[model samples]
Target: MTTAKNDINKRIQELTKALETKSARLNDISNTVIDETGKGHMVISTEAHADYQKTLGEAREIKSLIEEQKAHLDIERFPRRAERAQLCGPGRRPDRARQAVQVPV
Candidate 1:
C-alpha cells in the first residue's frame, strides 16, 4: 500500500518521464513536418501526410498520459481535503478555525 505522499511523488515522476518523451517525439515530428514542407517540390505527398499523422498520434497519446497522471494526483489528494470540506460544509466555523485560550488572570 502506498502512502498518499508517496503515491503523489510516484505519479509526479511518471508524469515527468511522460512529458520528456512527449517533448522529444513532438520535436521530431515538428522537424520532420517543417523540413518536408520547406522543400515544397521535393516533398512527396505520402511523406508529408505520414509525418502529420505521426504527430497527431503522439499528441493524442501525450494528452492521455497527462490526464492519467492528473487523475492519480487528484485521487491521492482529494480524500483528505475534499472529504473534510464536504463534512464541514461551506463557511468556516470559528471554533474549528481557532485554538482554545486560557486566561491566567
Candidate 2:
C-alpha cells in the first residue's frame, strides 16, 4: 500500500514537472509569436511563416493539455473544495503576501 502511494506521489510529481515545462515552453512560443508580429517588415519567407504558425498551434495545444493536467491535479489534491480564491472573493495575492491593510477609527 505504501509503495502504491509512493508511486502515485511520484507520478504526480512527474506530471507537475511536465506541466511546468510545457507552460514555460508555451510562454516562450507566445513571446516568439508576439515578437514576430511586432516586426515592422513582413519579410519572412512563406516556409518560415508556415513553420512559425505550426509551432504556435502546437504550443497552444500543449498549453491546453498542461492546464487540463493541472486542473486534474488540483482536484486530486483538493478533492472536496477548490482554492480559497476560486471559492471566495479575490482573496490574497502573492505580491501582498505579508502586507496587512490598516484601518483608522
Candidate 3:
C-alpha cells in the first residue's frame, strides 16, 4: 500500500509537471510578437494554433489525471487513518494484554 501511494504521488507529480510545461508552451505561443517597427501583433499560424489547441487539450487531460491521483491518494490514506483511529480511539487500550480464562476440572 505504501508503494502504491508512492506510485500515485509520483504519477501526480509527473502529470503536474507535464501540465505546467504545456501551459508554459501555450503562453509562449500566445505571446504577442514585437516587429521591427515596435508594433506588437499576435500572429499565430493555423498549424501553431492547432498545436496550441492540442497542447491545451493535453494540459486539461493532465489536470484531470492529477485530480484523479489526488483522490486516489486520499482514498488510500482513509483506511490507514480509520484503522489508526479504531486502534487509538477514546477508552481503547491497544497495548493491554488479554487475560487467559481458567478452565474448571
Candidate 4:
C-alpha cells in the first residue's frame, strides 16, 4: 500500500510539473507577436488555449489519482474497519430495562 501511494505521489508530482510548463508556454505564446497596425489590439491564441485545456484534463486525471491514494491511505490506517463495524453495528439493538414488562409486585 505504501508503495502504491508513493508511486501515485510521484506521478502527481510529474503531472504538476508538466502542467506548469504548459501554462508557462501558454503565457509566453500570449505575449509573442505584435500587430502590424501598431495599434493597441488584442488577439486570442487559440492553440495556446487548446494546449492549456489539454493540460487541465491531465491535471484532473492526476487529481483523481490523488483522491484514490488518499482513500488507500485511509484504509491502511483503519485496517480493521469491518471488524470494528461488526463490534459496534447500528443493526444490533441493546437490551433495555423498559422493554422488559414487569409483572405486578
Query: CA lDDT, every prediction?
Result: 0.64, 0.56, 0.78, 0.61
Q: Which numbered prediction scores highest in TM-score against the true structure?
A: 3
- Distance (Å) between predicted and true CA of 59, model 2? 0.2
Clashes of each: 0, 0, 0, 0
Question: For each candidate, what TM-score against the reference?
Answer: 0.51, 0.42, 0.69, 0.43
Better of 3 and 4 by TM-score: 3
Worst 10 residues of 2 by lDDT: 80-89
Q: Give the TM-score of candidate 4.
A: 0.43
**Candidate 3: segments with Cα more than 4 A from true spot:** 32-43, 88-105
Superposed model 1: Cα runs more than 4 Å off: 1-5, 34-52, 86-89, 93-96, 99-105
Q: What TM-score does candidate 1 get on C-alpha atoms? A: 0.51
Residue runs of model 4 more than 4 Å from their true location after superposition: 1-42, 80-105
lDDT of 1 by residue, 1-105 (tens): 457667766766776787677667657655654344566634435675686677668767766876787788777777777766655556754345332233366
lDDT of 4 at 67: 66
lDDT of 4 by residue, 1-105 (tens): 577657756765775676567556656766654574669765546775676667667656766665676676566657555555455455543333233433567
lDDT of 1 at 24: 77
User: lDDT, candidate 3, residue 72?
Assistant: 92
| Ranking according to lDDT, highest score first | 3, 1, 4, 2
State in Å the error of residue 11, model 4.
6.1
